[model samples]
Target chain A: MNAQFKKGVLDLCVLAQLAKGDKYGYELTETISQEMTVATGTLYLLLRRLNEEGYFETYLVETPGGPARKYYRLTPKGLAYTQSLKDEWITFIDQVNRLIR
Target chain B: MNAQFKKGVLDLCVLAQLAKGDKYGYELTETISQEMTVATGTLYLLLRRLNEEGYFETYLVETPGGPARKYYRLTPKGLAYTQSLKDEWITFIDQVNRLIR
Candidate 1:
């Protein structure tokens, strides 16, 4: 897949995944990477930016064998942003499909 | 639609448009912008880049009362690039749809 195209939708993927359930940094990166070839480094940077933007809030959860895990949860703003982007995504793909087909 | 998402597909959009038929700069922008909100200025810049990258070839078509219009047609490279990107587009969107849905 095109790198730029993947970058465009990366935020949505992260947001939607969190909407399903909260996941820690490594866990979130793993889930997204399973679906696409995104670099964990890139995902970390994006996660920081999204958290700073108030779209996501992070909390620390203690693990039995390791240090606390930093998990991300969607804020209200994030949910609203995801919904709007999801709607736009449908329309955008439909328009491109029309022209390409 | 997200501007970044639009930017990611803009190259494919232009290439796909040329694959349909030859079009001058203004005419191509007009056609694409009708389906989606793209700035003509941005389209012109992309046309120049694609032409420079050898994906597009240009010709001059003289009009009766107006200046000769510079037209763009998909080159062999452009066609191949479009096909590859189109294939990638299908898979990419499918992956994203799976995650979001």
Candidate 2:
């Protein structure tokens, strides 16, 4: 896996994970990392950036005998953006598939 | 399309194009731009970078009543690399499709 390729789609992966439901940082990281080669640092930075950009909102929930866990919920804008990215990615890959195969 | 996404796959696209036959910079750029949002500047920069990285070799071809056009041909390394990228892309997209849909 290329480093740039991982960086390119990491945001989309995070958004797609949240699209399923609100998830805390560790859950999101573990889910995506399981499927791809993503660094914890890169995932956290993307989360912070998207958070600052208003694509996601965070809420803290208390856990038993543990610190509060902050979960990320996708905003309306995030949902729309994810849809667009998904559409583009599908189209792009389809075109490449035709060309390469 | 996201700019970073474009940046990430541009190399694969160019190498795939050259895998078919040799092409000058403008021809490659036009072909890819028809399907996606890629700037001329970015395409040229990518070409230069790949050339410097030894994935591509360039040669000048004379055009009748015009200046010579520099065409790009894929190196053995480029072919192998393109194959790897293609494999990774297919696998990654398949995983994402399963998760998202």
Q: Pick the candidate with the highest lDDT.
A: 1
CAPRI grade, predicted model 1: acceptable
TM-score of chain B of each: 0.88, 0.87
lDDT, candidate 1, at B63: 96
Residue pairs in collision within model 2: none
Isolated chain A: TM-score per model?
Answer: 0.87, 0.86
| Best by the DockQ measure | 1
Q: After superposition, which runs of candidate 1 have C-alpha atoms over 4 Å from their true positions?
A: A1-7, B1-7
Error of 2 at A71 (Å): 0.8
lDDT of 2 by residue, B1-101 (tens): 22233246667788888999999998987888666666789889999988998989899999998789999999999889888877766676766676566
Model 1 interface RMSD over true interface Cα atoms: 5.7
Residue B68 error, candidate 2, Å: 1.3
lDDT on C-alpha atoms for all candidate structures: 0.80, 0.78
